[model samples]
Target: MKPFLCAAILSVLPFTASAAPSSSEVVESFIQAYNQHDVGLMVSHTTDNVTWMHVTGKKVKVETSTKAEFGAAMTDYFESLKGANATILDIMESGSYVSTVERVTWDNDGEQLSQCSIGTFRVTEGKLAEFWYFPAHACDELSLKPEVAPEVGVLQQTQY
Candidate 1:
C-alpha cells in the first residue's frame, strides 16, 4: 500500500506543477493584454494589492497602489494615448522577477513620442505583485546609437 501511494503522488506532481503559469509567463501575458488595451485582462494577472511604481531619477513614486487603481489608470492612459503600443525589445527572467526593455510609441494629437524604457516586475504565485518603470530613454538618443572610434572606424564596446 505504501509503494502504491508513493507512485500515485509522483504521477500527479507534474500536473500540479503545470497548473500555474510561471512568474515570467504571467508578466509576459499581462503585457500582451496591455497591448490589446484590455484593462480587465491586465488586472486579472495581478494580485489584489498590486503596485506600480515609476522610477524618476532619484525618486520613486507609486503610480498605482492597488489592482483597482491600476485598471482605472490604464483605462485613462489608453484614452489619452489613443493607439499607444509597447514592443518588448528584450526580456530576462530570474526567480520571481522579470525585467524587460521595451519600445513604447504613442501619438498625442499631431505629436508623437517614441521611447525605450526598462521595466521590472515581481510576480508571486503566478501573479504580478509589484512592478517598477524606469525613466524613458528616447529611442533616438545618442546612447542607443552604435559606438565608433574616430581612428578605428568601427569600435567594439568592451564589457567590464
Candidate 2:
C-alpha cells in the first residue's frame, strides 16, 4: 500500500529535462580549451560528428567534419603557431545557438598580427555540434563600415 501511495505521488510531481550545459557555456568552454591549446579537451566539448565551416561571400568551405579530423587539424595548427591565441570580443546567446566575435592573434617575424571573425555555434545535448565562421578581417578594420548619407537633394531629384 505504501509503495502504491509513493508511486502515485511521484506520478503527480512535475519533471524537467535533465540539466544540460547551456549553449554559451559549451561554446565558452571550447574557446577556453582552444586558448589552452588542448586539442583533447576541445574535442571533449564537441560531438563525435562535429562540423566546422567558413562562409565567405557566395562561398562556403568545410574546415572539419569529424572529431578525429578536428583534433588532427588543430594539432597541426598548434604545432605551427605555438603561441597563437583567441579572445571573444562579443557574444550573443539564443536558445541552442551562440554567436561570438573572436579576435585571434599571432606573432610573425617579430610582428604581432591580429584578425577578427564572427562565429555562430550550435550546441546540442551539452556539446558543440557545429559552427560557421564569417570571413575574417584585420582586427582594426570593422567588418561593417559606416554608410555615408545621401546628398540632401539627390534622392529628391531622382525618379524611382
Candidate 3:
C-alpha cells in the first residue's frame, strides 16, 4: 500500500506542475503585466528581496530592501513600455525554477525604437526573483540595439 501510494503521489505531482502555472506561471504573469504596461502587477509576484541580472555588464547591486524600492525599479522598466511588446517563445522548467525565452520589441509612431531582446527569466516562490536577458541579434538599423540594460529602480534588490 505504501509503495502504491508513493507512485500515485509522484504521478499526480507532475500533473500539478502541468495543470496549473508552476514557476513558468510566475514568469508568464510578469510578462503579461509588462505587456499590459502594469508596474504594480509585475512587482506583486516578486519577493521583497528580488535579484535582477542582465547580459550587459550592469549590476543592480543590492542597495536596499523594500517594496517601494521594488516598485521604483519596476517603474524604470514599465515607463519605457510606451509601445513595448513581449512575446514568449519557450519555457523550460526545473524543479522550483523556470527559464523563458522571449522577445521584446518597442515601437513608437511607426518607428521602431528598440530591437527585440532574447531574454530569459527565473521564477521562485511563484514570483519573479531573478531575470537574465540578452539582446537578440537584429539585421536592420530600424531595429533597436540591445544593451545590458538591468534597471531596478528600487534598492536592496537581492538575487534568489
Each candidate: how many clashes?
0, 0, 11
> What tens-digit string does per-residue lDDT give for candidate 3 at 1-160?
9999999999888778775567877787888987887878877877777766556556544533555676787677667656787777667778776776566677777887544455555666577666666546552423435767787775774887
Better of 2 and 3 by TM-score: 2
Residue-level lDDT tens digits of model 1 in 106-128: 88778887889899999998899
RMSD (Å) of each candidate, 1 decimal: 6.3, 6.3, 13.6
Badly placed stretches (over 4 Å) of model 3 are: 1-20, 57-67, 139-160
lDDT of 3 at 68: 65
Q: Which 10-residue span in candidate 3 carries the lowest summed lDDT?
A: 135-144
Error of 1 at 4 (Å): 15
Error of 1 at 3 (Å): 20
User: Which sections of candidate 1 miss by over 4 Å?
Assistant: 1-19, 110-112, 142-160
In model 2, the worst 10-residue window by lDDT is 12-21
Deviation (Å) of 98 in candidate 2: 0.7
| TM-score of structure candidate 3 | 0.60
Sort order, lDDT high to low: 2, 1, 3
